[model samples]
Target: MWRTQKTLLAALMAASFTILTALDFCQSTECQSYDNVPLNAEMSTQTVTSRWKNVSVSNTVQDMDYFRVSCKKLLEVFPVDVVDGNFVRTVKNCIFSKSIPTPLKAPLRLVAVSKDVIEGVLDLDLSVTQSDHFLHFASGGKLPPGSVPLAHRYGGHQFGYWAGQLGDGRAHLLGQYTNRKGETWELQLKGSGKTPYSRSGDGRAVLRSSVREFLCSEAMHFLGIPTSRAASLIISEEQVWRDQFYNGSVKKERGAVVLRLAKSWFRIGSLEILTQSEEINLLRKLLNFIIKEHFSFISSDDPDRYLVFFSTVVNKTAELIALWMSVGFAHGVCNTDNFSLLSITIDYGPFGFMESYNPKFIPNTSDDEGRYSIGAQASVGLFNLEKLLQALGPVLTKKQQHQAKMELEAYNIIYQMRVHQLFRAKLGLLGEEDDDAYCIAFLLKMMEETQSDFTMTFRQLSEVSPKQLHNRDFSQMWALADVSSHDLFPKWIHVYQHRLRRQMNDSDLERQQRMKNVNPRYVLRNWMAESAIRKAENNDFSEVELLHRILSFPFVTQETAEEAGYAARPPQWAQELKVSCSS
Candidate 1:
């Protein structure tokens, strides 16, 4: 009986030891929360100190820990003090929480990291492994000290109707960080987890959509378009059920997250939210913060500061739409909320570059009305700007409002001028002429009628010469196009030749080279993106890496034979690929 009692005591002792060890591990590694953690708590000194000591260090032996600790302490104590004084003093109504809800599952693998963005923007020597860890912590919903995330509230016009309180449903904005150049950038995690605004969403981003965003963001940046930059991509083993088509057919998919870096995430909808809620004081304060943070060059002391701000926004919007038109890019959802206040492309859902030169192409399957079609983007941009102007009603005087309207009226003229300039560059026309617009119109009309490949057509034009018009190569190229038998085709070419002749300083070769530089040989074609997605889903990441390399230098011809397939016309099956806002 004594021996039996001793064995029970021994078993009890072992169980107590295991429980103690687990409790210690939980304290040291993961800080699981039962409720929403306060943002202030997340930015506390002790919390940041613990994270600095626990997180993995990089290979660079330059005392990065000290740098990180110093930066974190500075941000924790004086989050806005480092920013321009105007912003720190004026901004209000921002939601702050100590700790955001963590993802359902931790990141299992590091998919990709945009090294160019990290080296160029962040000025950090973070290796892929380090980046992976950082992304997992920041985007996987792991809240460490100095990593407090903010979710901004906003309203928007969706499909020409008001969408109230549509804020960052699954996005969390981590505090801003200063780069080596002293430029401050806001880092945001999309598909991190649920927020107050996630009405019915699971708040998880699937791998398919995550991959699309990761590649497209980099592709647009390299294409010389202003867009939010992607830093890293992380995938989780957790499964997320999604009705990809919103048709009630739900399926489980792999979850993922993307870390997006930008100058600011403020949008027109942010202001609209304040105005619509009758928060006049908050609206004015937020406007001041925006100007102070992003447009510091425009002095707040000036009497016409608001008017000047409106005009600058108008100009930027016009230029952005013109750029989109030049590249045949259709942003499937041009909702006011998706329209960045700084005029950079933000969300990447359902976006498409025209495979054919059809101006009426609509990429989003949900956009049945074709309101945001390629042909309608410019008009929609102006429409959204008008909504922004309305949101500023509380701040502007009647006279100033009239002035804002006048500035808004200049959008069409500005858009036309920018479009002409872009097309001129594409055609290698050194001098602007009265007939240039007509020539461009004719070329576009011909392309639309023939259903010719938009990118390839311009690229091929660079190789054609006046002397080769009657040759077999030119005949073959012309045959490939849906050319009309009418004499208008030859007439347009005659006009084009006359324009080329005036550029005596540039030889044929120089002109071709110039055109090639402006016209990209590669775009993130639907087929290519689909192939990358499929391969990634199957655990083959080689295609994603290869596509990244090719897209990095889009304007130059890739020397490898493998790239030949990417440059060719997409397979017929590519036509059935549908992308929607859910993407």
Candidate 2:
């Protein structure tokens, strides 16, 4: 592996440095850098003709001026023969003619002819067009017809237990590249149709789920979390089959293809499942590749390379979980496939940020068991990383693996510590020790008792006076709190207040910025998304615009009451708007 690294570095750095000479990149639209070399250029050329025009552009991420999409690369990825007939574009569209602000919006011009697979992105905007779908069908796009690039694999626990066989099903990674900022990034397409792992399924993504993944990923990035960002989202209205719980009766399948952009779609489960194969060595090879691609900062010769990898990943997972707690996010389906090595929120299926503070709340309507509820996510993340460690254990010496296990085991401690620190910071407190943990748990208990607002609880606490802490309403909720028998919670708040008084920062604005960043004034409230969904379904994009605007500046205070709707919890009716499978 070290020799492989040394041999790969020259070629990799060379490609990566050339403003992104992506290694083995194949798709022309996404894999423009040298690393990306398309296999089906002959078929791609046929999808394009002089008639393709720009359709709808993105709305949320209004930053469209920064990109230079590669059209020639797009030609190489899909088919060239069907270009004239179906109009080559770069996505398998599920959304009709809707506009949502995309994070990296460039003109998404396309050739709009309905076909089996039309996916193309010319040197322009990252918007969706009909032609991309045609290319998917034209190039024998059910699965690319060659030895496909290996799944960037890793191991992770599923539902607190470890089984194997987790690889990309509806996902096919395009490649990785360095952007203009010298930032190394991954570019992979979700719903790029099926792959070898489709496992008797239609391997398509729906637009509804696609939009959620796309927007939420970018939002996490903007919020200073280690999150996968959506570069583009394309929707083709062609009917695809997926399961729908019918009329409170017949539960059957329906379908759609929603193309998504991600930095890296590689998952921990991808590694573990492969371990059960004769291809364990292949798993090792993939691990080496991951080390090279994402963990290049670590020195391979360092006796603690494996330990350091585990530590870095563990810390990242902790921080990510803490951030989710701050904003009240629940990754509805946090199975191995969605547990990216990068630890970013990858799949956005049935995902939601909390409005009211219900620690046990599960966002995925399909998750009857609450496996991915918000309260359990931290534990789940730790469990997943442990599974990863189990897979990587053999790669290092037994001694190294033991050391790695200790480092990984500390994830919960670091996570709880950070989470407590955030809660303190939200209250303008500058310090606390393990006492912080007690207070955090108590606060959660209070939130649950009052059916209190998660964001509002923190927000209002920013200005909480000593007198305010003893409010009759607060007292009633505190009484209902079913937290542990320890009186440590109420005791800690008193200690925290005095601590804050002594260490009050020099600048209120500085304190304000710190608190605001941690505690968002707006989240992607379930009610808000549903409101937008209802209106958007009827051809209205206004609610969508409003929700997008607030989420973009999640930490900001709205200037108007109308804009303040994002802060409210979902009403009972809104809560009942069930989302089964995405799309």
Candidate 3:
């Protein structure tokens, strides 16, 4: 009996040592696959279900379709260029160049469609989207009945210098459709083909970049950021070549197109080009038209309508950038042309959502100087606003121009206020306190030092109660565990708890609910998009469809998302990923 007891003790000791070794291995790089242990794995489905609001991915499609079958409405309203057909030349005195989309000659395949966007926004039946007519129309293979395609003509300040005649080189505006719901949507085909502005380049978008644009556009929208919508992504056998990294190594890639939707695509460059070309009369005409159509609140009779329009844009732009920061999104290209006058997320290229909290994170490989990093987006926004003010200089009175500059100056203040509100909500801090800002700053500093996952850090905080946080019990909460590794983490936690207690009658449950709403559990991380794109390039769009469905409700915890390892630590290969302005 004595020998058996000694043997049992020895076996127990050996078991303990093996478990510890395994845990240590998981903490190291060799166990990257299990980076996040999903501590709440035991939580009941009911508990998880209660956290998310029921979001319908698609509305019930009606038997009848109300899609406008042509571009006649837009053509009738806007001024046409003097030149009639597609040719590379300097365009003058026109809002748009009358051009036709050169259809893809190869066979087209409808890769994916946003049923919600079709039924909700366009008021079209879901059945209509599956038809050959829809496929051809979306891919630029066939024009809609009575369609008259037009390419917008605008110049821009590309990378802080005047880039003349940088208009819609590869996009054709297919026309405007006013849905039954009384909303107007402009349908445009990106990668449809060349226009007069397609200088020295083939008017095409490759599959890899097109996939990113399509996914990111829809993802941003569902993330509650204002953005242009993507109705469908179509792929074709048509071959296109691109030096993806701008290196000498060019590769063959399949051509693709996205049928994108927007209320209006008139950007700051719209006015800049007219002002640059000394088309003051046309500039004023365009401004008046925009004001009348989009800014109904600004009276057409008001002499200072342009000033009011400028002020509204400045305010909206500030709010937009603040929201982008809250979600850790970097647009990658914040050029004057890309910054929409409507203050929506447009021209999605080389964009990325922040994974690790690095201020100097540049998503676009072409952006060597880090001009459009996530941290610098707000400042870049100000620069773009300055260019916008300059664009409006020709139309504004001297006093109004002064007022516009003043509005531009107020941008930083407005942006800071919005950021403060958003970050406070992320921390689940109720009401204001003197130390709230400092506490928030301290937490962010610790997160940066530890290289914490930006999205999951806040999300994990939302998941854990104040008791767990106080006890430093971050087992299986991977992002929080990373952040807690900081030497000063305890000190920051004390400040945060003190600030949280200062709020009157804010229960832990209430705080959790508030934080969960603002802090999304998922974001379209670059690695996830890269995975989807790889399968898409192989003519397998299952992941694309899955990502679309998952991203449509990013706040929810779906079983499929968990099984797919989306919220898990990005795979090792993700670090080698690179995005450029090639597409």
Candidate 4:
């Protein structure tokens, strides 16, 4: 009996330590609340409009004085490659290459800017973004005063095959900025021209893809998902040619650049290159730097720190993928290089939000085999984690390697648990029931059979009353109307109603409010992005600006979004829209 009691106490201590470690990580990063918005739903329309003006433009615009100061923490702390020129060749023994951005041609246009990101994250006055100095700096025409631009070197497995030395071809890490909040953000320029990683291809991003990345980056943030943020999108008259579908029909499109920010750009591939090249010493140095900077909760002196870091990454990666599933988002390219080591969503390309509830939905036209579909993301996540474990093999002992594998084996359980928790919150289920998982599965199956819209079906359920659901009155809820057409929907509704009755303390209004907070009314649908992109290509950024503002508060319903048909059924032309890996 004493032995069993002692074992139980040891388990309790381990669990407590895990909780404290998570708390420490959160404190270190200063976690951003997903629910906070600039506008309040309870306010009158006039008041909301008045408050939006104040919130968006609260700070005065200033000159470019703030651009004089920049930090080089990565350069100061690590060794760079000996090769200094922007030549295409294999690089070794470096975390980054010193590459200068080839400036975009003149006649640059500032298309879109995230005012909230400027004011909140950068702690800069919004007016500072108005000058041509901001445009030039963002587009690589002129570097910030103290910026030391560099390109990250990494490798990844594309689809299922190992693609070696797939580093930053067109991106240049400008410098790091530490804001008033003491949060450090690494700023990078996408489409800032070529580096050593550019292999026979132009190192520029076209306007078509740049607009999508900009809008979706901000949209994902407002949805409460952990993601890289976009500060500005600038377009230029420089021509870029692409065979968008590899069909030999090349076309000329204008170049564009986006200034994006993230805590760290390191991914599983960052270590993969070092391991594959047998750079064990450099790998160890990079690993220690990551732990010291990001994973401070794990002591640098601990011999088992690598194992602990692997475990933390495994748990957070699972949670991040679960959040993606909850929102019906498919990363499209789930390659190891694109998966962030910090567990935030990064490298937005060919991504799509599921319109119809098909688990087989493939967003990237380049994915002919449907390897990175919506339903396959969780499994692909496991595959990437396995690759990550392999990358850490050189540094880990035999016993630690086994422990890391054991931690990886728990990924599916962790992912499913987070998914269940998030879906429960979406359905406003206060307490547990034996049938909760079954209920969620049942509704998804029905949605699949009926081809119901994924985002709106859950959103309509939140807006609907129990009486409406029972009476089958879905006249006003088009998404629910599509769902209710299924004969089994009645059976599912009965099960859901019975489940709701189990909530003792939650009133209908409280339940509705809870559900509404999680179920967003709008997501960046490909069609919506296409519409905005068409106008953006013609130098009409009105739609792009409007979409950004509306998506800033995705949970709250707005009159402009309604009038613009953002919540309506997608147009027929949208079915022909295709996104590939061209850009």
Candidate 5:
């Protein structure tokens, strides 16, 4: 019996040592060197579900009817000039390779699909048998014919300093496809895989970030904000390790890839890289290409077309920023690289909707200095435009350069005008009065001081009756404000009532309805996203689907109490969430 016990103890000790060694190996630098792993050929043969049988790999290019893929127009329009060789080089040797579909780990499970986008923009019948195949294609698998996947070359100012040669590191532009309406849309795969521009990082996005982006993109679009739209979200069986908090704590996370649909993936950084490299001809070529592709409304034959393009961009960007402010959105990282040339909200990283009306709120924990704070977004928009103007200096004459400066100067005025327009609509103020601007300013200031729930305050105000002003019990809107704020609220309400009285053309019911239309009943709060993400992580996607449906019609009030719970104040734990660049 003694001999048997000794033998068992020895064996147990040996097994313990083996387990520790394996764990050490996984954590070691040598074992974690997956950044440069070559693509596995066998991965291409991996099969998806039988529902996606129609989306098969085609031997003949003509058979690839999943998407109406077109040839590389951007490349064709601009040949391999001196700038092409020195400045805009191919991302990888795979640029010329005919088979460019980066293999995703299977089994590929579809987490979400935008049916509205499919029927509307894609012009595909959602009830048809081929719809499943189209959705499969949208999941980052089965390349369309004539697909030319290439990583765009660009650079930008990251955090107020020049960051050189930063392009689409993990993103691949799979050419452009023309919709049924003859409008072209670019389909890009994010978190597909690594490229030459990936640097030392493993070009993979975790499921956490992918889910956030997929939902937020569509959410912004539904909110009437100019933003990129998500076609589909696909998750893999593979596990990836990520340090989500940027701290030492590392955990294995599921991998995902999101298919992002956009008008164009061009950024302000695209021109910046060319200008900084002194590639003047290439800069002009890119500018001309952009005008031809996106800004075709502006005549390219005119000599001052570039100037007009710059001014148009400025106007759009100002309006975009105003919309963001009106909706209480804080884009955590407002880096120049993230600024879209078309003035749409492109990248959704570490973004947060303002819970409390605090202008100083910074969503990104990594942003120690509130550079991209809610209050600073307007100024940052101007700063990014200034950087763009610098990039366009080579193509513009001295007077044109001065004109660009003047356009940049006009951003503030344009931004204020748009903000005032939106606020006036939200407040149901018709025909702006002399004190209209002051009244809006005073309300915002009070909101900031009282730390009121930004979205709920406006939404609740839509239901408040003019008769409720006299009764304390009916003054439920004032509950959002502090004690000091409550004391000053009556004076503000008196002014507001006077303004409403001036708008006698519309009845009180009409005024309330107008306000309700402008102010959304629900916004994508952090807690709501967290709840959906938690359930998705557990392989239960019901909540994600629920939120998707609810957010699609943000202005509509839900009939059920359970559904209305989403519009309530966030829980305590959710208020402490630390979303960063990793998220």
Candidate 6:
């Protein structure tokens, strides 16, 4: 018995050592190194599913028949320009995963891949992959030279007024694939080289802009805003032509890379551009494909198909801008081309959240005139939606077009309601109401006057009781805070507190959770931008890696991390940093 006991203890000690060693290995290099990892390992891949590819991979006009075909495979796909360095390799498969669960033929099917335009389709075989894309930059190998897949066929509005021709100027849609869970998705290569859309331009994405996009996309996802996901970021060692240098050089050249992900890279501009031309047949085909690919739930027989589509897009854009307004997010370029045809958020150019709630925070260095200002996004969104109607006029009947125009006109009201609701939520108020707009305008006025920090002020608004509100000496806010008839805010707060009381059971805690989830503690703060730019310029992705980690759980506080500098606003230098849409 004594001998057996001693032997058991020895074995237990040995097992403990083995486990510790393995954990360290996963934590150290294996988790971070992308190239060295075994691609075939079950632990490395993720299950992908979706109906986006249920249609067809070939650009054939199969109508809805393309929806029935299924594919599953992973082939080692390389880049279009090998010499210039766009080598983002992955297995491409066609599976589209959106809001709905797609009907799939096989559970997990991995196959061979070969394509010229798309590098390759990858089979993600792991049960779970990293949600945040930073894992790749953190531990992965050298980033491939990226090229914007020349998907320039689409068109949309600009600043809610101008209808500009825009396409994937610095973005590439790699291919679609199924992950371990049988989900399908599109993996696009952004910042990859230029396509026909280049139009006398260099197709490249700078590391600074790429990092902002990579971090912000995940941050928005956490905030419950519908947004595109970032899969992997591969920056090249080579520089390209850029008017504004990443390191403050006024030169027209710099090194850049490609960002890969999945989504409808086809912007609203794509549809608008094609419609502007005489491609009537192609326009009809695209409309059919869109319904099958994205809005399948709606049928052709529906009397209000166009209206329904318009309304759906309007509400989505409305909610999207409202969320941005509440968060102080300025999309820098709210141009129709920048707006997703499908109403999803993409293109993080000169994007910034408000440090000061002035409503005119313009982050895009190129947006000199403040056309896409923070306060103006809602109206701008309405402008873009109106263009969608004008573009559809060529296809829809005069009567149908009239109806569509009416629907488009309603965007302003719908957006107003959403914007008001967001303000109430930020102020810890209850549901929608008629007087909501007044309360909102009051808050905005106060914020503007007090020079409140857009994010921090709203996150702290619930702390303001009438007594607290008074003590703060916000006499200016009181002028606007009062309701038209009922001493507005004091009465509203009375009701708000009562509502807050009912939620006291557990909703109080739940409220905090919900608000926090909606409000990210750390954004890719402008200062962090400089840090990411410097590291990326040096081909060091440590800063990028750290930024991804913080952005991954953007709602959670990460004080102890080395990128702790994220907590502060940009120093004087970040102000001098300017970015154009061309970059």
The candidate that wins on lDDT is 4
C-alpha TM-scores of all predictions: 0.84, 0.69, 0.88, 0.90, 0.84, 0.68
Cα lDDT of model 1 by residue, 54-128, tens digit: 334332222222222112322333223122211112233442223264453653677788878766765555563
lDDT of each: 0.70, 0.51, 0.79, 0.83, 0.71, 0.51
Instruction: Write down the RMSD of all candidates, one decimal each.
Output: 17.0, 12.8, 16.5, 10.7, 15.9, 17.8
Per-residue lDDT of 292 in model 5: 80
Candidate 5: segments with Cα more than 4 A from true spot: 1-66, 79-101, 127-136, 472-485, 560-564
Task: Quote model 2's TM-score.
Answer: 0.69
lDDT of 4 at 180: 46
lDDT of 2 by residue, 1-583 (tens): 2232222222211222110001122343332233343322222333322112232333211122222222232323222222111111221111011111111111222211211111222223233233433234211232222212222323345555554443455554433333322343434556654544444555566545555665566566656677665444443334555454433553222223333344456677656655544445656656665666579998756777667877888998888887787677888877766777777777777888765567677887877777777877776777677777866766778888878878876775677556655666776656554344444555565556556667766765543445545331244222222221235546645755555556655355565566776777666666666666566545465665565555667677787523455544346787566666544
Relative to the true structure, candidate 4 has a C-alpha RMSD (angstroms) of 10.7
List candidate 4 stretches off by more than 4 Å.
1-61, 68-71
lDDT of 1 at 473: 42
lDDT of 3 by residue, 233-257 (tens): 8888888999999889999999999
| lDDT of candidate 4 over 1-583, digit per residue (tens) | 2333223222211111111000111121111221222212133456434533533345532555443324346767778889988889999989899887877887778889999898788766777777866777788766665566889999998897789999999999877765544567888999988999988878899998999999999999999999999999988889999998889999999999999999999999999999999999999999999999899999999999999999999999989988998999999999999999999999999999999888778899999988888877877888888888999999999999999999987886677677778987888898766567777777887788888999999998999999999999988888899989999989999999999987888799999999999999999999999999888877899999999999999999999999998888878898888999998
Model 5, 1-583: lDDT tens digits are 2333223222211121110000111233422332232212111223212213554322112222444454446556654222222122343211122213344666667788676776666555544313434434554454554554666677898878899877776777766766434567887888876655666656678787888898899988999999999877878767778888889889988878888888988899888988887878878888998898789898989899999999999999989988998888998999889999999999899999988777778888898887787777877788888899999998899999998888877776677667777887889899866677766766766776677778877877787777765343344454343422556778888888888888867898998999888788777888888888999999988877787888898888886423547666667798778888973
lDDT of 1: 0.70
Candidate 6 lDDT by residue in tens digits, 261-349: 44456556656765676566666656655665578787877766766776678778877886776677788888778787677788777
Give the winner by TM-score: 4
Worst 10 residues of 6 by lDDT: 14-23
Q: Give the CA lDDT, 0 to 100, for residue 251 in model 5.
A: 91
Worst 10 residues of 1 by lDDT: 16-25
